[model samples]
Structures are given as structure tokens and as C-alpha cells.
Target: MHLYYEVSGNGKPVVLLHSGGADLRDWTYVVPFLANHYQVVAFDGRGAGNSPSPTEPANYVADLLALLDHLEIGQAAIVGHSMGGRIATDFALEHPDRVSELVVVGPALSGFNFSQEFQEWMQRINAAFPDIDKVIERSFDAPSYRIIKSSPHWELMIDMFRHHLKKTTEWGTFESVWPEPPAIDRLGDMQVRTMLLIGDEELPDNIRTAECFRDIPDFQSITIPGADHMVTLTHPNELCRHMIRFLGG
Candidate 1:
């Protein structure tokens, strides 16, 4: 099934990928700014947002490639956040010729071992069984939501989560999207122009994950202060500035 996607403007192809539980709406704050100079596309990956439910675990890298093919975009830059970041990295690694530039925000690697703090936090969550809203606030909203607590966008984000939260657990877990021979192990071989963005206040695991790519040639990593995992929503202008520069806008 075709994914639910939005395309705007008419320039170089630039695709926006969202985080684990988020759909394309994750890019709402950044899309118009980018559309001014890019053929910006945002889509709901399988089982997220308005996309069709998955029959089994998805090969998201391939799915993304197919999406591009469907759009007749032979080559394009990719901008992804969290789970989307993981997919973007995987795609660049798997199909280097198709990517012009890569941007990953708060990426999680396929084989990345969770930081000790994250593992402990998961254990705590299981023990306490916090409500879904509480879970999102802890895992996604925390440091960032506090920065935009009074805004309508914050409430919109929360509502989006409430709507998509059902499928997250039902579709697949961590092991679903993970293919053997993870991305972290093959970083040395990938030379795609890459820019990494991480929120300084995000979970320790994510901060640790982004650090792994720092030494790769042609790779750039930036940190946004007072932000959390969902930096696109929390700090759109700052992210757009960095992305526009890297994208040569």
C-alpha cells in the first residue's frame, strides 16, 4: 500500500521522516520553511499516522526507497528524526548512490545497546505501569515539552500520540525493524554527506547513540540545549537553520 505523504514546493527532493510514534505531522513546524527552497515530502511510515497497517515487521529502508521511486525522485536528501533517522541511515548505507545528503536527529542505531540509564528506566516503567500519557511525557515530551508547555502545538502533539499509541505496541517492538549487521558496525563504509542533530537534554541512551557517529569523515553532529528527543517540535527554527545551511539553502 502507498504511504500517506505530503509534498510541497519544487526543488531538490527532501524527505522528512518522523520518530517512532510520530507520523509526518512531526515536521509541521519545519516543512513550510523548507518548502520555500526544497521539494519537501513528509510521510507516515507503516503503522504510523495515516499509513496502512503492517502485515508483519517492515523493512523500512526498502519502504522508503520504494516511496522515492514512486515519487520519481532518483536522488534526494533525507532528513529524519529518531526512528526515521535510523531508517534514513540504513537507507543511505544500503543505497548510497540515491542519497545526496543525510540529516539524522536523535537517531537510534539498529544494534545499539541501550545505555544503562535507559535500560533501568525501562525496568522502572514496567514496574510502575505508568499510563500512556505519562509514558510519552517521560520518553518523548519531557525536557522539550516543558519548553513549549503553553503552546497549542504541545497539546496537538499529545493528542497525536494518544491516537497513534495503539498501533505502536501492536505492530512490532524493537527487534522488528532491526536487520542483522547493524548500522553502527558499518559507519566506516558509508560516506554520505551527513549532519547529526541531538538534543542535549534527551535520554542518556539517545545522546550516547548520536555520539557514535562523531568520528566519521564528512559527518557533523550538533547539539541543541534545553531540548529533548522531539527537537523538531521543540526547536524547529534552530533545526531549520542548521538543516538549511547543510542542505546549501
Candidate 2:
């Protein structure tokens, strides 16, 4: 309930969960489009953006539930990007009745074994550690970020990454608790209407993750041409169009 959040327009609720290494600003371009049709709730997840750093192991799913309870929203269409998508998927799985629909953009799936190359890439970034610039530079070097680096939103993306990295230095704990058995093991059990969005230029691990959700009974998948991992920023208009269609707005 203490998490920072912004609300716009009015209709059935639509909650926006941002990607990791960024904040609610991730939804800046997409909000305007969706807000016109539905009540949009954009929030800074704990330890990201203006939200307070986690004092213990982070419980993102619980934080989301608390946010809904605080807002008195009984059910909502949940839209998430990257790590946010992971949280959204888990939330729908654990609290199906609370999620009217689910949409994941370049999502990370729990229990999906990322390729060794991806793991090494992350390890290299972590090796940079306290050197924020190096970490940021290495992060943007990933294939998934190839498009965003050249987009007009490049500086803003960098700013958010810089801020998030700096804030991590102040966190009490780095652990984020997720539902048991992992989402990969439970995708088939997801009952909420679902959609998966990915950029054509996305990393292989992410593409595979998207495939994992394809078998879900009510799932839909979209690949934004010319987009990369930062589809939210680089292709917000296209993303919103697909989302509105899927959500029936």
C-alpha cells in the first residue's frame, strides 16, 4: 500500500508493472493510449523508482496484491514488461480471480533456464558491481537492448537504469521471493485471459520464454517488428494497439 502509484482515466482497472532496471517511467508512452480507454494504474514497484527500498526479502506478488487492496480494485487487467511480466504471471497463477486478464511484454519466466551466454552476460555486469557506469554500459550492450540504444528515448532509458542501479546499492536485501515450483511449471494452470508481447529483436532466452506460455489455453502472442527488448519505449503505439485489441477495449 505504501508503494508510489499514479492513476489516470476511468473504467475497468488496468495495472501496469514496469520492467526491471527501470521504473513506472517504462510505461510513460503507453499510458496515454491505454488511459483513454480504461482506468490505468502505474506504480513503482518496491525498491524501484520513488518507492522505498525493500527492508527484507522482497515479495513483489504480495506488494501487488496489497496495492489492489489499497485501491479497492477487486479485479484488473495486468500488463507487465520484463521482470514485471514474471510478477504478473505469478500473480495471475496465485490469485486468478483477481486478474481479469494478463499481458506480458518481453517477460522473464520463472524457472526458465537461460542460455549460458545470457548467464555469462549477467555475470559480467555483476562483476562490474559498484561501478555504475560500467554496469549500465554492459547492460545496454545486450542484444535485447540493441534497438533502444538508438531510439530517441535512449537518454531517458539510461537515466532510469542509472537511478535503479544506484538505488540497489542502498537496498537492505537483494532477494525477491516468488511463488513456489516456478511459473514455467504452472503456466498451464493460468486461468486468466493472457497475451504475450515480444520484439522481433529480442534475446533468444526471452523468445524461448514466450514459447513456454504459448500452450496456455487462452494465451496470445505478438512480436513487434523492428522492436527489441525495450518494446515498451520503442514501440509503445504498436504495443498499445495490440493490447487494446486483446483486452477488448
Candidate 3:
């Protein structure tokens, strides 16, 4: 359960969780800025980076809980991206009082409605070459996706992608990881203050997902202009500023 991680600064703790197929290194750009005001801890999720892979998808939650237990962190803010966000939502819901606050970026929780355009976009992404190398290359070379490519953390992003793809078995990814249930309904019970972050240019469904939690008394959301789904990498400073404000650093 000793997942690879990096921590810096000295203040109230803030844990950063990477997205699917990404590692603790993915937050290289954002963590330093956040570290200025708050202690920042970034770690790879189970099955990614240096974390051990589990046979069942649900074990990820256990892995996260074990991590928290190991760290002896009683209460802390959590900033999670994509798959990490889903795990964060679950953690907050199950252990409501442990989270001081929650920040979710590009969260992919299920059960939200999707428009036709958004559906088509999902299809396109799914249809994209399943090869991680090609996907990483396309992600960088695409003109519209240049924002992330320009980030100081871009090299780490690419390296993380390469590492996951190399460590993952073809069947393990398809069978053990993909096609798992999501944490959409469980979010409503999350009692901690939660801020959902997404990019202005992101797909409509992603935006809608953020909107879905707007009515929750503790839920809020914000969108960054000129940013894509990879907002943390593309606008790390801005993202850190918002997180600092939300986390009351």
C-alpha cells in the first residue's frame, strides 16, 4: 500500500490525486504552487504509477483508505482529477467528516445526462486508437490541445502515460479496469464542501456533470476560460489559486 508519492511545504495537508493512467508526477505543475501556501501531497492511484494493482476495481477505495490510515492524516482537503475525483467523492461520502474540503477536476462520475454532441465526443475518444502511445502523441500534437503540451508538467505527463502502458497488461486494462461501476449517486451524501472544476472548452457532458452538484448546499463549481479537459496542466496557476481560495489556505 506504499503508493509512490511526493510531499512538500508545511501547513494544513492537501492531497492531490491523479487521473486514470496518470501518476503523482502529473501534478508537477500545480503542486509546487499549491505547496507555497499548504502542504501538498501527490500520489499515484492504485494500478497506476508505483501503486500495486488489484484484481477487483472496488479495491481502489480500500487502497485509498489504507493510504489515509498509513499517512495518519485525520483530516485534510482532497484535490482529485478524473478517476481520482470519483475515488475522492466516494471517500468523502463514506468518511464525510475526514475531508475538510473536496476539489474535483474533470471528474467522470456516472449517471449524468449527456447531449448528442457529448455522446459523439465520447464515441470519438473511445474509438481513438487504444494504443496509449498514439493517444499521448495525438494529445500533444493536436493544435487545439496545445495548452497542455505547453505546460511545465507535460514531460511528466508523457512519462506517466508511457509508464502505465508499459506496466499494464492488455487484458488487465480491458477486463479489470474498464467497464467498472462509477460513483455518481453516492456524491449527493458528500457533506464536505466540494468544488467541481472543469474547463470552459470541455465537452458539454463534463460541464453538465459539474452542474449536477450545483444544488448541493456544500457544492460549487467553476470553469476556466481557454482551458480544455486538461485544465490542471494547462492552467495550473489558476487552478491552484482557486483551490487555495476554496481550501481557505
Candidate 4:
């Protein structure tokens, strides 16, 4: 399927990948900030926004490569959040020649090791009886959303959160067809400029992911004090600051 995408500005390509529940619109604030200096590309992944589901299984990394081909872009710097970050990492690994730089925010690595504490916590949570409304509430516990829960954007966030969570219930993890390998082991193979961003207030497991990549050559990481999983939405200006510093360097 041809995914829905939009491009803006006129310099190097900067592709934005939204989280699983999000569509292209999640980049609303970040896009303009980037478009001022780069050709920004934001797209709705398969089954999100206006993009229709593929006839077969979805291989997001392949889909991204195809999208670049369709746009006639030889290379791009990828910025992805959560699940989108996982895709960005996989694509950079599989097609190193096609990526110039890669950045991920609160990303979920395919085989990243979760601390025993985190794993047990998740097990406990998953073992409990499921409640749809409670599930939606739990989603807000993510640091970024927690910070924004009382803000002007709170209501809008609630709706978006509920929508995405519901979609997960309907579609499951969407991992049946196009499973990719764990990237932690391949960190040494990344050839492009790479940066990992994590919010200080985010879950402890995500914060620890930075330490996982610190030993790799040329890998850099930053922790945003007042931000969380949805840093792009909660702290776009701060996020842009790091981005401008890295991409412009």
C-alpha cells in the first residue's frame, strides 16, 4: 500500500515517524520547526491515518525504503518515536547506504534487555484483569502524558490515547509478518550519525536504554529533564534544540 505522506521545506530530507497509535499529525508542531531548514517528511504508517492496510503483512522498514524511492530521495536523516523509532533503527541497519543520520526518542528495541524490575512489573500488570477504561488511564501514566494531563492539550491527548489503545486491541502488536532482528547487537554496525533521546521522567527501563548504547563508538544520548515518552508533543521546542544541534553539527 502507498502510505500517506507529506513533504515540506527545501533542504536535506528529515523524515518523522510517529508512534504506533499516532498518525502523521503527531508531528504537527515538530514539522514546521524542522521545515524551516530541512525538507521534512512525515507519513502515516500502514493502517494509521489515511493509509490503508497492505494486502499482505507490513514490513515497515521496507515500506520506508519504498517511500524514499517513490520520492526519489537518495538519503535522509530519520527521526522516529516509540515504535516508529524501532523502524528507523531497523532501516538504518538494513540499508545503511540510504540513511545519513538516525535519531530515536523513547524507542523500543526489538531485543533490548529490560531490567528484572521492569519485566516483573510488566508481568504483574499484564496478569491483572483487563479493563478498557483503566487501560486508557494507564496510558496517561507515561511521563510525557502525565505532565500534560492537566494542560490545555489534555483532552485532545486523552482522545488520541484512547484511539491508539483501542486500535492495538483490534490489531494486536502488528508483528506477525515482518519481524526484524534485534538491533542492540548491531549497534556496532551503524555507520551514520546516531543519537538516542530519552526523557528523564520516562519509565526507568527507557532511561536505562541510553546506558546500553553508551559503549558504542559515536553513539550519543541525551536525557530531557521535563520530558517523557511523548517528548515531541510535550517538549517540541526542547526536542528541536537537540535536533538542531545534532543535525547542524
What are the clashing pairs of model 3? none
TM-scores, each model vs. reference: 0.90, 0.98, 0.83, 0.87
Quote the lDDT for 240 in model 2.
Answer: 92
Question: For model 2, how does the per-residue alpha-carbon lDDT over 82-172 read when each residue is reduced to its tens digit?
Answer: 9999999999999999999999999998899989999999999999987888888888897888899999999999999989988888899
Give the true-structure RMSD of model 3: 3.4
Instruction: List the candidates ranked by lDDT, beginning with the highest.
Output: 2, 1, 4, 3
Per-residue C-alpha lDDT of model 1 across residues 46-124, encoded as one tens digit per residue: 8888887677767798889899999999999999899899999888888989999999999888778986766876676
Model 2 misplacement above 4 A: none
Q: For residues 1-249, could you state the per-residue lDDT of candidate 3 as single tens digits?
A: 567777899899899888877888768789889888988888877667777664554455566667778888888898888777877777777777778998999886655566886666545554666666656664454343556667675676678777876666632434333223344655555678999988877655666777766755778788888887678777888898888888886
- Candidate 4 per-residue C-alpha lDDT over 18-66 given as tens digits, one digit per residue, 9 for 90 to 100: 9866777778788889999899999988767767654556778888999
The candidate scoring highest on TM-score is 2
lDDT of each: 0.82, 0.93, 0.73, 0.77
**Per-prediction tally of clashes:** 0, 0, 0, 0
- Cand. 4 Cα-lDDT: 0.77
Could you tell me which 10 consecutive residues in candidate 4 have the lowest summed lDDT?
171-180
The alpha-carbon deviation from the true structure for residue 201 of candidate 1, after best TM-score superposition, in angstroms, is 1.4
Looking at candidate 3, what is the lDDT of residue 66?
A: 77
Cα lDDT over the full model 2 = 0.93
